[model samples]
Target: MSNSNPHRFSLESFRRKLASVDALPQLCVLGVIAGVITGCLMTLFRMLLKLGAMFFMPDNDPEAFEQLTPMLRSALPLLAVTLIGGWLALHSGGSRHQIGIAHVIERLTYQQGRFPIRNWISQWWIGLVSVLGGLSAGREGPAIHLGAAASSGLGTALKLPHNSLRVLVACGTAAGISASFNTPLAGVIFAMEVVMMEYTTVGFIPVILASFMGSVISQSVFGFDPPFQKAGVEMDSFIHLPWIAASALLIGLLAGGFVRLARSASRLDILPFALRLGLVGVAVGLTAFWYPEVQGMGYDSMRLTLEGNVAVDVLMAIAIGKLILTAGAVACRVPVSIIGPILVAGGAAGALCGMVGNMLLPGVHTDPALYALIGMAAMMAAVLQAPMAALMALLELTHNPQLMLPSMLAVVVACLTARQLCGCDGFFISVTRYGMHPLQQPLMQALSRISVPAVMERNLTRTRRRLSYEQASALLDANPEWIIIERSSDDKPALAMNAAHLARWLLEHTADDVLIDAEGMFDLLEIPGERLELAPIHLQATLSEAYQCLNENPVDALYVVHGRRPDKPRISGIITRSAIERYYRYEDQSTTKNR
Candidate 1:
């Protein structure tokens, strides 16, 4: 058994510290562990994708879906959908089908970041097949899911506290993005801006460390090549700023439509799962039949757009076709990844805009590559409502600080257009609309960071339900704050009474000159003191959990215990509802004062 002593440097002690808000050192340690685990898993995940691509894709190129024959292009998605549907059918219950970034966010917000092993296993195969079969899906989404699950599993196996598990999940999220894209800074920003939805010094250090380690591991295996080629492109003149902003407005509108379409499509639960998937297969296959550029992640197409090689008409076609098809697939809930496709579509749209600008104003010297880069950032920011993460990604991917000025303009414009003009919530937020919002209340977030042991009252004594008058008098000598009346049977609940109340009763009986047998038994339940019903709660639980327990149970206060077993619980402390309220009230005051 692990040492439970708080003073000792042990796993239990480490977990206890993590339950507090200032456990930066401990969280950073866990961040490194999560990073290492996520990096290995992501490497394996990429290798599996590479291996699967080689089996069917020509020359082992994962993005060579356009090179396949039209027959194969149409048939691949059908085969993939049949397989994915069959795999899902095999485990047809609960949330086993929930896979990808939205699922990760759901677990973090509602389930204390405890990922289900079943969903993790499903994502591995489904993600592989989706890309290999040319489903227009991105690998990064599945990669994030895998990384977060791996870290959550690690925390679960170690039996770490829930607060620590939450941080581990965030670490894995950053590591996943870092490993998949080879962009550590962007990964860290994405974890904070998109997934965690909150940023702090305590959170940033660990996520940064995890993201760096993930990039290190990925680079060690993949030779440090970025997914996109270094553009070496810069804005030629300030005159193009107006055009760039105009393009951002259009991209923002497109992003809003994409989100709305996908969210509206998600409500089509009236259709059977198999039928919905089949429809998606047919739609993608038909689109691929004409425009093979729409197949797979379309990164190759994105590369061509960035190189300014694609014709304006073709770019427009690809931008529109990809946006519609991807939105459709997402609506069907086919587990198809959307990020890569969104980038490809946005880049195509931007390239088209640049071509149009060149035609309309010959002296402006418009560069399609620069526009493509800007569009990628703007669309991402608009769709995800994460401008900081998108901007970081744009800078890291291009390795050009010159793009920051234009990219910022585009990102802000796009986000404003999508959020205010189009009335669009972020894509992930739209999908997870039914879940409890992570930032719903300030007090709940505050309480979640504190453990029961931090606020629990330990000044109490446990005793049998019935005690001799002399025995009670002796117990009062210790001056405990409260007295616990132990249950006679396991089925009966434990009771607690204020020690002062028992002491007052003892004094009154002795002063009244009442005849009392020295060995007479005093039934604590029958005494004049008010007795409170107590329920058992684990020591690792947070104040939020204790509050939840009090709300769910009829008991007045919770008794903290050390072990999981119901029959042999080791009582450690007590926490009342008022204590929880008082703690948060004080926290609120402290925060106000600090400001």
Candidate 2:
């Protein structure tokens, strides 16, 4: 009607066009493909690693491995595995491929959520060979990262909504785990608890589709049988809760110890990555010499335990060995998941604990299988610091209702003890320490984020306190939304005399003992309570964020950092809420344009 050009609509149209890059059907198709590809990769990783171990022994015969010369069998596996691993690692899928779950969390929060293709490839390369070469590591880490990366790539190609993309990433991660362990429900929970940190309907949709699809893919490739899963009793016994809780506490403490030691050892600058990992391989080789059952993810060892052959003391020794091996393995950062090894280690510990508990009780006592089950849940819960994840894992792995109460009971104690003894909660601990906020920030969470530096306004406006009433009114009219105050030159605080308070101060007009400090300056000259100081204490950002402070106490302009003495508050800027709102509007528009 007004002869306005239709070009204005072009901007929104362009955004829409950019966003329509990837189609939904195509994304789903690619997602399924990615899951299948990731599944095959994991299977190959398992197969190759086992082959490496088999070859390292020089004899196809299980009994013949030790009979072969120690120099040939033991030392050779160590040397050959590490060197080849180092070589493969040197050219690993690509340089960026080492990115793990931690990096994923970071990119999601700060960047446009683009995980590098190189990183996923490199992780697969590193994780697969390292595992096959007999490094004391697990495959779940690479599986999760790769799966998530695959989803991210799909989302990019599809140009899906940011939220949808995030969900896809979570789904990919869950699918990897489900496919890896054949724990479907556990996979779902792991995604919700570990990655998404929220179990909302929106998040659940894609994760369910992705996880089930991955499971379907894995089943077709690996077989319908559950990888390490077993069916057990209804555990209808309520009496076991107390004992389970006790065992969980003990296991939690032990798991926590291993986690702390592992992190510390990994930080050792004296030992290089290659040597450290090789040494761990040597350690694992030595472990195999005794508990040959402990080699290769320990699933077979678990099977051996359920069959009731391992001695009590031997089980204990193997359990400790597995913990140390896992710690040493992860210390090298040779690309593996702590989750798998943790499960294995927990099972080993549980078996050991069960055997010992039986021996100590002697007549009417807890079954070894029962204790073993409880131990698994407890340790997993403790080490992972995720009670729900551990519980779900137990349910999926055992399919035993009898173990549920014990598992939940054990999980509670384990999680509590781990948190108290070890400052950080599981998986994302390192990420939290580095300072980027996560979706699920645990207890001491507030300690890290509850600071002036953590949350504050970004942009701000300036003002002076010496202006006349008319000038002040003009400034006021200019900045309707922001409040103005004064600042101090030295170690003094920034003072903000709120416009509302100042107006009332003018009406009240009498100087009294009512002068308050805004920054570090005394506003006692003649202002009333209405003209009280406003501004945050040692804070950063715009007047907008400080408005809450103004509204809460009743005040005006803010005193800010003087140019010379950055720490000291000086009268540098004045702001009214209206001006701040307008600025915020402009800023919001600018940010949208840039995006």
Candidate 3:
């Protein structure tokens, strides 16, 4: 128990300070391995994306790869046809193939840190194809998956212990983010702060190892700096706070709208996933007529926003256009994600707002570049509700102060608005969609339910007096599974008298008072199992879950704590063995009648 205290402390500290490193030194090598795998995977993903681009090129394009000949380009429909092959091959295995972060988390709680290795590759390939086929997706889904998978896979392949595997998975997730974005610190934060949810020494070693390794791998190929560079950000005037706040509010509202729209649009009750995604393709084709910039990754839109290339009229239109398209694409739920599209829309909107500010107040206006940065940040914060991720992204990618202030302000507002209106943080919404709750610290919740503090009984016989003949006789009369002779802090011998042994003793020994006084004298001798130990309840659990905790307990009786603290444990009472039998009987009867 004392040895485990350090692990808990590390996790707690890691959660508080995202920038800190406090994990174990022993796990450092694995973290580096996680980073290398993540970098390799990211590079592979980029190459696959290039391949996808080549496949979709028009016949007339001079830039078309030799691999995709003009004839194949002419028969463009073939590209869409074969893409399904990857998805099918990947998803057709077992139910385990459907595993996501949620499943990983579920395994963490009950299954001693086991994760499925064989199934990860299949889903990984499927995600890659989804993006390759113009599904309006981002790298996040696959990046984290690959990151976790690679680390978890490594642990599994090496035949490490269960706890070690969990640590490896954390390393993988961190490395994944590092490789994907070249944001090493953010990668560490993502793994420790988000995935592992451990802030203590446990996370420190893994997160640092993963982050550093991932950064090294990514830098080896893409260089140590950011891939896409722009001018440094500059601070804006405090007078523009109102404008920034207004923009933030508007982006938040739109973000909420986008979330709802996406969910609703994705609902193809009768159609399959492919069919639904194809429907999104149709929308893209139609929307392309008006705004072809929305066709691909919207790189053009981001560039144009920074350059202030679009007129006020067109900027607003592009914003709305991307918003609708993103919502629709997300609804279809193929390879769709809110990442690239939200940035595009938000940047465009911010640029438009900047233009307006420039027109209205000449000297006090915000910069186009600044607005562009803020827009990107705001939309990302709103849509994804990952303020730290967005802030770090802008900081690492742009390193501009002029943009930073508005970006931070807008991001905070947008994230808050999205949370208030949308009923979930961005990642949580996705987690919830897949039938899992996105808890900040699940150990906190798990500790609340069926914990040793909650289940263990404190009512051991405290009196050290040797049991009198009358008292021993009385204790035997009451049916106890195991009777303790006395309350003891440490190892002390107590009379271990079971009901059967007591009855046998009574039959042989002619104690005349035993038979008469022992009846209905349960409290005369202290029943050790009567006292209850209490722990905090995290609340919102169903009665059925409570029942489960009660049933699995070692003791025949337990308490359903109304609240967490023992002294103030609200309205609940002790649950006796007889009460449990009756409740089960009632439940069974109810089920039978309902059936």
Candidate 4:
């Protein structure tokens, strides 16, 4: 125990450093670590998908579901869902079935980013099966879940503080997006705009580093080529702006309807998992029978749409089919990836609009591909409610800066239409509404950034409920600000007494000859000092957690402790409600001054 103290103290010191708002160097190192971890995992995930495709897909093309016979295409989703449903039924306890970006957000918001190992494992095989089974899903959602779980697992193994763990989760999320899409800047923006839901200098540095590392690692394996071919198509005239805005409005309505459908479907969660997934299989199977282009991620369909090779009617059919099928899959809680399908559908819709425009104005020779690209960005922004991320993804995917102006216009219109006209929050937020809070309050956000140790009062000492006069005197000789009255039994709560109050009581008692001989024992609780009921809090807790603890427990202060044993935990420090308020007040003032 004595030897462990030094090591534990060093670790606690490290945690304290991370609690600071300016721990950029430490966080950047963590970011790099997270990126490398997530990147490697993402590579493995993609490789596995490719390997799976080799066995089932003709020509080893993941998107070659179109080449499969209609009967085979129809059967594939049913077979895949059967396996998935059976697997989920075996593990039908707890939240093991909950997987993907929505799970990531729930963990970050409610659990401080600690991911469960069971769900992480479940996501690997389930995600693989969903895409391989031609379930109108993307690999990106599963990749994000895997990345976040891996990074959070690393932090857990290292026993990092919760506040730092939150940052690491953000790092992993960005790295997942970066590795999956090979878009580092977009990855960082998505992590901030979608997952973390806030941006800060401290967060940006680590997320950026993680995203860069993820992209670098992914590029090394998959090469430096972007996913979509550069269409070399650009908008030639401003006369198309009104048409673009009109298309955005339509896309927004579709996105909002998609969200609404998914939310309404979530209500069916009370049904058996197998029943819901089986229905999803039937819907997807029937759709794939008619339009195999809607199966899988639909990247092949997207490519065709962008090249204007597909007929206008085909584009419209693919768009509507993908949207409804994907939404139905989501409603059935099939764990299908929505991002890839959303992009594919959006591009198709945009291409259909572009074809209509060309027909309407036969004199103009604008390419449908331009509208497809802009539509992809606009739809993504509307569905995710992340305009900056969508724009970044557009810029990176297309490697074109000129489209930024027009894409921005379409994105804003789509986002406004979806949010105002359709009344839909982002998809992830809406789906996980039961377990999520916006956490948008400024004071709460401010408090979450700081760990308890950063604001806790260390000028304190712990003693038993009863102490000899000399022991009490000796304890006060240290000039501690507070005295912790250790509970006599496991069931009783510990308490805190102000040192000044104890000192005054001692002085009065001594003057009255109550303890002149210094032989009597003093019951600290019985003394005339204000005693605050104390709840035990872990040393790694953030100030936000401390604030929550104070609110949830009928206590005025908390005794910070370490170790797993509640009966014999090591009390490290004391934090009063007043102390937390004072710290936040100082921080608020400092921020105001800086502003």
Candidate 5:
């Protein structure tokens, strides 16, 4: 309503501010919002899972699928998969099936942080069904999917810039991991390493804040108990460190094998959704029939492995059987996560090694729980290609500052083995390897850093396609950069003329007192102007989008607008290839030279 109020609250101003590198304070606010939203969602999801567990199990323990009768245990996966597959089969279009961590990565890399509501809605039910049905699944994948979607949607509603939205997505990702595991430090590292794929001191502060908030919310509800418990874990000796590192190497190989199998199974995307799910479900059911330890999140089994309560033979069965089944379930697009199951498999492998070591060398002090802790770190680091995050998780979960040396050694060995010997990228990337690359090149990366709103020319005046003498005279007085030609009813502008040229033309035909008909006498229509073949891009768009619009169409310039809706977009500014090129060429030269 007022001049200063409108100017201060304008979307263009907000977007331009977001484009700067010093957007930490605003991002911290968004981080709080993301943390609260994701924390609440995760709490509800966990409660629902508990409620579902009450229907069949003795207690409300969702992980206790083993307590069910053999017939019910075998039938649950098949029945649940049928219903889930049928539901997914019906709505399987666009981004419906794309609902998990891999999908989250794909959207961030390609869609510029815009996640669809359809996929977000589907994630809630699909994730709930997976764990409740007795399939070897993890809740973390669904939690991340739900959290990232909620954060992205919040940014979208506020008309935030894409760069800001991307940061919000990272915040949601951190919140998801932190709330799920109560490991705030690990959550921050995981978001930076796995999702955002880049890190800076300015960018990480908000992420750290969001992770801490998520942990606080979860701690209020779930209390201080983590998924795994350990008491006073210490290394046996420096001599046994070699055996532990060797075990990490084996876990890395196993991780590589698991990823490869999942990738191979993902090729069955051609098959009908029901058939693929039915086949995987049958496999899970048959496995659950014999070894129910393969069902649910397997955190219970992981706890037992740490306590040395699980027998060696049963541990071997769970370690191998859960690996193959979980890999297949994920590859076939079960919409479940492998984070929890991977930890279980690693713990089981470590427990078996500890048994063998104690039997062979009777004089040595062998603590299998310590080995299990190290194994959990190694498996997570190798499988996700996130060594720092896994190590942080190990420290936070154990609450022991002294295990850093062994954890780091195991994580490094595992990561090296997976990358060098096994020839594997992280599982998320390996499965979704369909010709997508990050903005890695220096110039492109630099271009992507700032938003279009920050760089676009805002010193322009809008007018009708044809201007009268008096109308043109008044516009020239302002000395605007360009005059935009448009009609009130049209979606985009018609053309833009250089204000200098119009000013020059007006000076030459200055016979105002002679009563001249400028339309016929001067023929002002022949004035030089650039034809407008402009495409509509959002204020949140980066220079990468500007380049993309130019490449995809026969257009030289773009109109920067506030929103994506077709009917009511508030036109803000304009951008051109020359302007974009000059901005980068002048500003980035020194940075590029140093690099």
Candidate 6:
């Protein structure tokens, strides 16, 4: 019986339509859905963070960890850490603990963008505990993890094609950043530069739409205020270029040092979860007692730096303190993000440079606000290796075109210094080196553009395991491209013979010799070239999957199948490796012919 529900039917049709080569329309719709979902979830995450802060903070200020008594300030993080550590120790969930940006990248690379629900659940509480307990954690990481997982989970629930799921994950990533920072363009660039690591016009359109919707949803809930608000400032003279270069160098050095520290901490994986977490808690507690600015996302302190309200010595301490504490906390596997703290540290470094400039060279005019803003941009560029996205974010937050030229110089210098002199790629790459697979090459990118249903030969004949000579001849005469011999057991293919080969064999051999018996005909067909061993792949498999199947196995062709369960397998069609090669290599041929 057909399912009578309209929603289910519509979803089913959508899933089916998503298997085509031109799935961009469907993917853009999915992006809208992902954006809405991520935006709502991020708002909720922020609201919950405020609610947690209300419990202990004065006037419900989320950044008021400094106002708590010394004993409470130290004890609260310890208590939060103990609970989080104890819960993880008991539940562990067998690899579900891997929940963050790095985990998202790993799953996209190795698992085809399938994020488990268990990790999503873990991110919710883990992020909450880290921030509520006054640990130097950022909300962006959890927001991204939750958003990406939710969108991927939607695809998984609908049994969508792998390509669609991968796109949905990228959509979610864009939405997450957009919702978190209200910088839609930066979010889109960030998804391409960091998450997808490759971009095409078709891929970018959906991400752009997702980012727009995410920003809209976030603005509706929280007023349309940029995360950072500062008075207008500009680079007054060309004389400031040398100072900007020096500031970028210092910021790059700090970013590289942070990456090194985080990597070192990640190496202590042999330590027990509770012990490592406890040590992180203790470190945060000790640091918080001395430098409360390091607690939470440190946005309040960053705002002070922009206003030039913070003392130079205090700003220097906050910069170094956050760099060390955040790196250590992340290394200990704290379920938090580093992006926010990295920006705060960068701003502090820039503010320090601005103060020293005013002291050393009193004649030259200097804007500490400009330095702080440029520092934030440079640090983000250096740490994430996303210079364009960082620059876009700076423009969006400050909305000052005059800041662009100096910001560009600072961002470029910082990136080169971090990568060339300090010898580090970025924070995420440094700590998650194992998950850092190269982006798909151009040919593989072309192969992944379309799915199996679009390329697989649908003109196929299904027959019994053994076929009579007359039946085989008649089947060949029908001009079916493939003949699938039904298997008695689903674990192995019975036979997948090329009809053209069968026709040639019939022409070469006498009917009397070939048609001695059904068993004899099958035995003769077992000779090389008569048939190929079949690797069963899903009907929704992309050309990339077909190529991978052929490349990884000895099989020459893959049988497109319908059911996922081994017990209920049904042949849908067949695709040969040669067909896949021809599909992509045809472009190469066309270019050659044009030349």
Candidate topping TM-score:
4
RMSD of 2: 11.4
**Where in model 6 is the C-alpha error above 4 Å?**
1-13, 93-96, 430-436, 486-495, 506-513, 518-529, 564-568, 586-595
Better of 1 and 4 by TM-score: 4
| 468-584: candidate 4 lDDT, tens digit per residue | 777888888889999988887878888889999988877876634554335566577778868999999988788888999999999999998867565577877888888889888
Better of 2 and 6 by lDDT: 6
Query: Per-residue lDDT tens digits of candidate 5, residues 402-426?
Result: 7789888999999999988988887
Residue ranges of candidate 1 with Cα displaced over 4 Å:
1-7, 93-96, 431-436, 477-479, 486-493, 511-519, 526-531, 552-555, 564-568, 593-595
In terms of lDDT, which candidate is strongest?
4
Q: 511-532, model 1: which lDDT tens digit per residue?
A: 2353444656667777687788
Question: Over all chains combined, what TM-score does candidate 3 have?
Answer: 0.65
Ranking by lDDT: 4, 1, 6, 5, 2, 3
Off by over 4 Å in 5: 1-16, 93-96, 359-363, 430-436, 439-449, 464-470, 485-495, 505-518, 521-533, 563-570, 582-595
Clashing pairs in 4: none
Say which prediction, candidate 4 or candidate 6, comes out ahead on TM-score. 4
Report the Cα lDDT for residue 49, model 5: 91
> How much is the lDDT of residue 339 in candidate 2?
67
Taken over the whole model, the C-alpha lDDT of each candidate is: 0.84, 0.59, 0.56, 0.85, 0.80, 0.81
Predicted candidate 2 versus true structure: per-residue lDDT over 382-446, tens digit per residue: 88677888888887787666677767777888888888876547745555544533555432111
lDDT of 3 by residue, 395-485 (tens): 7666554566667888898888888866645643444424344334332323211212222232322223344545655655545544433
RMSD of each: 3.3, 11.4, 12.3, 3.2, 3.7, 3.7
Residue 550 lDDT in model 1?
A: 93
Q: Is candidate 1 or candidate 3 better by TM-score?
A: 1
Q: What is the lDDT of candidate 1?
A: 0.84
Candidate 2: residue 175 lDDT (0-100): 83
Candidate 3 Cα misplacement greater than 4 A, ranges: 1-23, 51-82, 93-119, 158-164, 224-228, 265-267, 310-318, 430-438, 441-595
Which has the better lDDT: candidate 4, or candidate 5?
4
